[model samples]
Target: MASKMASCIFCKIIKGDIPCFKLYESDKTLAFLDINPLSRGHALVIPKFHGEKLADIPDDNLSEILPVVKKLVAATGATEYNILQNNGRGAHQEVDHVHFHMIPKPNAEEGLGIRWPQQKTDMDKIKALYEEIKARM
Candidate 1:
């Protein structure tokens, strides 16, 4: 079974089952304007391959996606943009497939922002966690 939703909005866009304002496209990547844009030039760049998480995508597919994103920035004449890729439900991933949000931020007030609660980290626990990760690696 495919990890991606057959009826997903992105999938529809990819399959040309739905219309989109395309900015750029290559053999392995597609860049299109966000249907529900956060800003004027908000767009998403995604791999042609269906993968729920970034790491699930093969390296070549991952590699192809970003150049399309860069091209979009140049094409839009965007002075600054934020590249975002959220993973899992805890990270506000509305879509199941791996995609990069390239949101143009012409001004401070025009783009993505979220309130994150910062907490003090325990150095001892951090060290232990790092050790565990290193051991697994």
Candidate 2:
């Protein structure tokens, strides 16, 4: 089965059933300004094929999403940007499908602060972590 949403909000936008402040598009991909943007020109890029999660998507379909994002970043004149993807309810993924949020921070914009819980780690433990990953290889 294809990973897609018949009733998904994005699908509606792609189908032109809903309106979006669009910036760019191709036969396979769509780019539009996020309605509730983190900042101005915040855009969402998605494949026409809808997938609930990243692993559920085909490689070629996933590949098409980013080049469109790069084009938006350059067109918007954003010097720095972030590509954010979320998955699962626990991950704060409000949208179920695989889409990339391209957030641009022009010179005047304040960078979003990531709130991370603090944890203490010893050097030996950190080194053991690297060794463990290497062992898997």
Candidate 3:
């Protein structure tokens, strides 16, 4: 486990030190509308505690997020939605604090998506990676 962070945007928001369009808050979680939204009702749900990446987050904090995400989805009246979690700068994570983007994509007509490139995989390498991960588990 890592130590608590300072100057984290999400933590500042939770502390009322930073202003945000808050949608929901529990003892350890908060949901707020995104200022730079993909769509009109796009929002972010996060743990009140700072976790730079998904793996850094506590299970209890993680569990609190999905329920709030569901509420945000329903409130937006979206038929379909995407849950986006980013862990590093390479993954397009602008913020270091752990967060889930509950983006409401009603259809193909609107929302965030880039061309997802596909590639062929080597079966041997795939098997080796799987076994390595399973061993860690």
Candidate 4:
């Protein structure tokens, strides 16, 4: 069995140490409403198996969460939604446990509205980054 971080909040919720407004639970996964929700039905889908980053999770565990996200979007009458998962501090991942945010975008202006200020950079720099990442893979 894979090891789970004992102090992780998601692990605590899975262990029933903390209470949650539970939405769905399976033998290997759990879906619960986010306490600091972006919208009325903003939820978090997490694997019962604890992992700090997406790369740390097994494919089978990671694969099970999307359906739950869909289920929530439909139930909430969300016209659109954003499925976001962040890794590491640079990405603003407040929680160390790997989790996906299913933020329902009911309106265009509210609930985690995004403004991407696009910056044009040199193509050589971008190509170098791509090559560096490809080498690691």
| Steric collisions counted per model | 0, 1, 0, 0
Q: CA shift at 58, candidate 3, in angstroms?
A: 1.4
User: lDDT of model 2 at residue 53?
Assistant: 88
| lDDT scores in order | 0.85, 0.81, 0.85, 0.87
Q: Write the per-residue lDDT of candidate 1 for residues 33-134, one digit (tens) a residue.
A: 898888888999988788888888899888877677888888888888889999999999998888999998978788888687998899998999999999
Q: Which 10-residue window in model 4 sums to the lowest lDDT? A: 1-10
Q: Can you write out model 2's per-residue Cα lDDT over 1-137, one digit (the tens) per residue?
A: 33347668888888999999888778878888888877767899988777888888788887778788889888888888788888898977887777888887654554343568989999999999999999999
Tens digit per residue, CA lDDT, model 4, 58-103 = 9998777999888888877888889899899998798888898999
Estimate the lDDT of model 1: 0.85
Arranged by lDDT, best first: 4, 3, 1, 2
Question: Which run of 10 residues does model 1 get worst, by summed lDDT?
Answer: 1-10
Q: Which stretches of model 3 miss by more than 4 angstroms?
A: 1-4, 107-109
Top lDDT hit:
4
Per-residue lDDT value at 93 in model 3? 96
